[model samples]
Target: MAEPRFSRFAAIDWSGAQGHRHKGIAVAVCATGDAAPTLVAPPGASAWSRDDVLDWLLCQDTSTLIGLDLSPAFPFVDQDGYFPGAPDSPLDARALWKMVDDASAADPHLAVSSLLTDPEIRRHFRQHRDCGDLFPGGAGRMRVCEHGQRTMGLSPTSCFNLVGAAQVGKSSLTGMRVLHRLAGRLPVWPFDPLPPHGPAIVEIYTTIAARAAGIRKGLSKMRDAVSLDTALANLGSQPHRPLARYDDHATDAILTAAWLRANADRAELWRPQAMTPHIARTEGWTFGVS
Candidate 1:
């Protein structure tokens, strides 16, 4: 008998502060390389102590390809609110909710549908009701473990901005709508009804590409949207009238590019890897990407 081949897949819906984090992260680890992912936990209890969470994360099969909903980078701001750097925001749920509401009002087609109905969505906002925790202050506690680098959290505004634009939209939508939102644009709108920012078209593109790649189910209608032939043709490149800038859309495209690059057999090719750091181990954490 031969040993079975397997692949470990995981994703996190990151949150900080008391009660703001999801109940449990949506984790899917499988012993079969091609097996469909399964939910490891609900949206509650997802927040474990740092050590325990790290232990669980590191304990996963070494072949795992972990996708974190948290931003790995932040945005750069020069002037005119046109932040050019990576995106981030403070961990304040109220502020985030307000942003979501404002952004949703800017465009009707931009909200993630699941967020509108998901009970947990409101839970996230309600958790931060009274505390006066400020932004840029709690970043240190919301650190992201990227490429083995240990650092404080990226600016939540940057993450929201990057995702709200186009470069970092996939992660944001995933966090906002749960994985279901990434199912692709079709009968369902990708933006949350009360989205923190304007609709992210690039996220739409990424969702289409993800559906084409078979990462999501029940999106047969989106097949044509993410086809490689369509991507190569670049036809219908222009989407509906814009309420936001290209950078927002570009953020989604960039995330789609990452997903496609990571799983070319599934989606269309958009951008190539420009740079990837070799993560070094710190504090007993051996982190690095091949």
Candidate 2:
């Protein structure tokens, strides 16, 4: 079979913080024949808003495959839904996305603080507190894919754990809002059907791309030009200039974009053994996690 090919590849390092602009958000893009990915900023803006990214995505002309570094859904299978015992929890991933979008309707830039403020929603998470006793038994809060990532040495965190620097719950929640808005415009992999031609977005773990680029674990970020170049080279690309910045968000976006460009044709990534129908509908799987 012919391999999948896209005209352009992009990756976004998303942030869930409340604001009109965020430094934590970074975007990188590379063309099919490009030697390296380049960090992209909004045309007239220094920083990118979640809305800015959505607008840019909608304006794209070519068939693009964008990788987003956030969890697409929470641990629904194991927990029986977002709100475990609550009778009104969402029925599926689409429903969950709508719930998050609806709850954060009043927040600027799609910030999910309002959803976190809810008594029921806040109870399942460990936010800004080290208390493990809040959750009953404090286990199974992570999804099956998260455990799979851990076994692969990626140090995946639970989407339900909203606290700590390593937690991705906030980004995921906010991303779901974006996903809900992009429902018909762009097809999300494994959840929505792949279109005949156009843009599609997929969930990505930047650490997985970093590992594929021969980066060692325990290193917090890649800032040096040599290391960045080497990592890009491993993914069939090289740095166009010195990527000496200390921002892990920028580096991750650059690396993952190149990785997507280099490896998007791999059949194994599209088909995972654990991506059952229920899991895809309730708890989405990471694109590269098999």
Candidate 3:
């Protein structure tokens, strides 16, 4: 049997202070037949800026596809073709929609009129039906749920999931698929071997858990909230609200944990490290990610 083309692949989970600065930009790379993936940090004392991150990412000579969990671009189809999400100041959900409009006009092939109603798109979107309401243009809208309807301020089940809904879930789905694809391409630059399957899962778990544990510790340190209610109050006036945003530190850590737990392999290798200046310098990875 032919070996899978990809042996070395990397999975990165990036986040802010709510997450671990040490593991803020978690990276895991593995190679075929290797006992475990060599988890390395970039050598530096500087934190990663948006541009720096992209520069570093584009600079990676790994030749292997790099899977980034961040929004590389918005995956939406307006009247036209596809549009990539831009990293711009005042970046928000609204800007994303506008770009979709622009992409549609610039390229005729890019229009998404048919894709929205396509059976495959509809089926794939159903997995996240709870969050969005897809409206077939001129065809009226199908209410998916009350919460979605209220959130989009559209008639129940009449709004499109492509817009205000399913952001996190959709991004996650995209990330996982990218990871799988990158894993198929063998390592190219500064190639390192991957640990056994068991250890790999362990490392992934530890990294994610470490981030979660850090968040719990920080909340404790600030005395933000000993209880859920107190924490919510400390954060704002909202009742029963989470201290952290769904896309904030907690979400990333939780998602990372979920990913690790799901991909557990008995033969993988696991290892983690603290962010020490010497270690950071030696590893050639940034110490502080701004």
Candidate 4:
């Protein structure tokens, strides 16, 4: 068995919907043992704001490993660059995060509304009515790990396509801003080498965690205690306490946190076969994508 690398694992079900507080957002955390993950209530009886997540993350001890259900970057590999043909595009992930944060400096609640409005940046995405002229059709550009997800019978959304219910573009843009803020304070995997000890962040797809927990594909969303507990049990986690409401957002975070606890020390997960150094620096990968 792999030795434990982190004492606590946390998962954040992030949202990119235009709002200060989002009902779709949820957070769950668990420890090294088999105890079930606990849903963290948003402060003030309201839904969790993206900024609230950043604040909570900053407060977590160094022993925690945070996983977020948001893409840290747009595709760069297929097109040979993040913004093909666009001059002076960010050279690396940190620069991309800086550009995103700078573009939305005026946006409140850690949102990146202003970033989407930027003409230069807007040319790469497919927003509501306007399909970017540069937008590559037929599923858009995909990162290496995204392709792996498809190979494993999981469909991963391209961050460049901003339409549809599963649009990851907004979430990614907004999360990039938070990532920029956390740059010096926390080390995001691949962007910075995984430190020997300290709090670190990794991009996580809740579906990946769900599938690993033995939840069938396309049916990973748990809407009740029984389904949630069954998935938890598959990961050697104890049964979760009864929740007043069992929605996808809550269940996803809870299950992913437990999954993170179980898999953090896996050697192959940290070092994927297809991930080259250039890919890691250009497009950070999703955890468990190997």
Best by TM-score: 4
Q: What is the C-alpha RMSD, rounded to one decimal, of candidate 4?
A: 1.3
Q: What lDDT tens digits, residue by residue, belong to model 2 across residues 19-120? A: 888889999999887478888866688889999998887887688999999999988777677787665899888899999999989888888888887877
lDDT of predicted model 2: 0.83
Once model 2 is optimally superposed onto the true structure by TM-score, how far is the C-alpha of residue 28 displaced, in angstroms?
A: 0.4
Q: Model 4 off-target regions past 4 Å?
A: 1-3
The list of candidate 1 runs beyond 4 A from truth reads: 1-6, 16-21, 42-52, 76-273, 276-290
- Each prediction's TM-score versus the true structure: 0.31, 0.93, 0.30, 0.97
Candidate lDDT values, in order: 0.29, 0.83, 0.30, 0.89
Better of 1 and 2 by TM-score: 2
Query: Which of the two, 2 or 3, has more lDDT?
Result: 2
Task: Give the clashing residue pairs of candidate 2, or none.
Answer: none
Backbone clashes (count) for model 4: 0
After superposing candidate 3, which stretches have Cα over 4 Å from the reference? 16-23, 71-290
Residue 214 lDDT in model 4?
90
Task: At residue 97, give the lDDT of candidate 1.
Answer: 35
